[model samples]
Target: MDNLRKELLRPSAESKQEVSGKVVSYFAILLIGGLVGTILIFLTVKGIALFTGNHFSLREFLTGVNWQPGHHHFGALPMITTSFSVTVFSGLVALPLALVVAIAITEMLPSRVYKFFQPVIELLVGIPSVVYGYLGLTVIVPQLRQMFGGTGFGILAATCVLFLMILPTMTSMTIDSLRAVPQSYRQASTGLGATRWQTISRVILPSAKSGILTAMVFGMARAFGEALAVQMVIGNTTVMPKGVMESAATLTSVLTTGIGNTVMGTAANNALWSLALILLIMSLAFNLLIRLVSRKGVR
Candidate 1:
């Protein structure tokens, strides 16, 4: 009788476990969905409120080059252009170096050397943005001033600092992507009398192209969204940049600098909120691109 009771209780316990797992899974899904939905709703409502409450036209907001709050002009074309220019230039500067470093670590470096340096490379990711900013301000800015003869604070300084900040991310992602390429492919390439370098360049790289592109996207996104470090170096000028050495302001920098200064519900404040909305949309677009690329790679 005791054995019979134990058997029945075991079945009941198993059923309970199954039910609990289902409940937990559903709860987790709901929790994540709720959080995402809340964020989307909030951003959407606030962005719309900016236009509704302030009577700002979206076209003028996007096309306006001047961003004077006191003058009642809130053109963000300059900021938009600066943000794209800095992000693109920084990514361009960092991507090749990152790829080379990643390839060296995975393909050329000895196991011991690779292990010793990989952690050091990753440690860079943990360094505060302010530290990078300070370093750029103290070290890089002065060098630029001496060499190029400007205030030493401009798009160049911002781009260089952003390059350093995004390098670790790009390198780490590229390394992982390269490593994920099947060893079988490398072996087959080698078996076909291809040189190691040729194999890596043609076979491994092509196989990992999607991931490399994803890494570049992520790096560019990091460059685009960076605020504190960039604000510290970029001259924060409202005008469109005339050259790489000229003063410029990014969307993020403007938002950060102006948010506290503007009164609530005012047009200036609403414009800043609009900038926030633009950043959010940019991030979402990058994320969507990454997902599409990843799916295509998998297929």
Candidate 2:
């Protein structure tokens, strides 16, 4: 009787063990998706890069300073300049405004007012960039064209459009960061006779430094990599940006223009891939810096 009961219980226990093991295996597979995706994408892009005369000699590409791919003189500086100028300009325009707006929303406003404004800010995030470009095309581009006297679509117009496009993202991220800090810090400062402004400026801002940097750097990457809205507003000039009002071409724009026009195995294709590789590296560096800063901030 004892042997019969033990044998009957053994199979049931084994069945339960098998089912549990299968469920655990299913979860383990799902959790590794990020690593698998990154590996796959890296392999794909690298393979494409290798086929396009991938070499270490980017001297002509980076230092030659001309970038007329039709004539085979592919200096990337002009495109880089356009990219740098627009991103820097966008950062300058958005940083202070986003910071102020985020601070107002998170710390200064009454809860009722912040609640009212929150939906509008969130809605702005989902608005299509093309719609923003269309508005720039109709309103900002024409206004700038009249004031600056050229194709209304220029670096100035691109910067303004990108600035508006990136604003909500930056502010939302900054607000999250501000809210992450402990309330006790604020209360302690208040108890010590600090004004609300002083408490925020002295105790809160410094403590939230890494969060703030993360937001701006993310905005920088978005502004730098933006293509469609930028191409619509930017006049597609290859020359260096002469002024903020001047037209310029960026790395993303170059990639866009070359996609259908350039041959697959040619130097032009290689150049575009090289430019893409550089952009990827730049974005990676920005993210790493954010991580480093955030690590240091964890006091």
Candidate 3:
């Protein structure tokens, strides 16, 4: 009778609800995992078709400087080099400035000023990439021509445009990172007789290092993936750049400009797929790096 009474009083409906919730959660996870796996497999198959189907030497594909697809020359080294150069140069220019702005908004400024600045930075992120590209074309290119001489379409022009495009991203993310540093850290530093600058430099910044790195990685990813804007200012030249001011092509610029012109299953199409595969791999690498950094930070 006691057991029967206990069974009668039990919340069986709660257990059923819990089981349903778990089922839904597991379904969602599996669905997403399957989608990602399908995409990866598709890209891998298509990308490798360039080498396997076309019989193009992988070494030549990577190291060759010429990219005349119609004539059977498909050296991608110039585009690869230019991509890295632009990504690196833009990140170099944007990171320090972003750090300064983030610190000012998060740590140094008054709350009201911080509020005002935060929305402004967010606004920058919402602006269309084409608008930025147009501005670079109309305003930045001519200025560069006057200041440095050249057609103003080169690695430097692309770098400047990317710098502006990425600055807001880095700054907003850094601000969130700095703000995520516990108030206790600041209190502890102050209690230890540290000055404001010393506390921020030694305690807060160090604590937020992983997040800052993640922001920079994300910024680099954005710069690397950008196509239309970069193509507009980068001169879309297929040759290796002799200098920052010389016309150069990036993987994205080449792919965007040429992909639509080629027929399906052709070497040209496969080559573009290879470029896209490179981009996918880089994006995965960045995500993996962020996970590693986050794990280390937790440890």
> Top model by TM-score, which number?
1
RMSD of 2: 3.6
What tens-digit string does per-residue lDDT give for candidate 2 at 1-299? 99998887776767899999999998888779877778657745753463345553456666667877677777788888888888888888898898898889889888887788778889998898888878788889999988879787778998999999889988888888888889999999999999999999999999888888888888888888888788888888877778888888888887887767988767667677777776777777887877887787785
Question: Each prediction's Cα lDDT score?
Answer: 0.91, 0.82, 0.93
Candidate 3 overall lDDT versus native: 0.93
Which rank order by TM-score, best down to worst?
1, 3, 2
Best by lDDT: 3
Give residue 172's lDDT in candidate 1 (0 to 100). Answer: 90
Off by over 4 Å in 1: 1-11
In candidate 1, which residue pairs get closer than 3 Å at backbone N, Cα or C atoms, i.e. clash?
A: none
User: How much does candidate 3 score in TM-score?
Assistant: 0.94
TM-score of 1: 0.94
Ranking by lDDT: 3, 1, 2
Q: Write the per-residue lDDT of candidate 1 for residues 100-144, one digit (tens) a residue.
A: 998988888887877887798789988999999999999999999
When summed lDDT is taken over every stretch of 10 residues in candidate 3, the lowest stretch is: 290-299
Error at 56, model 3, angstroms: 0.9
Error of 3 at 5 (Å): 7.2
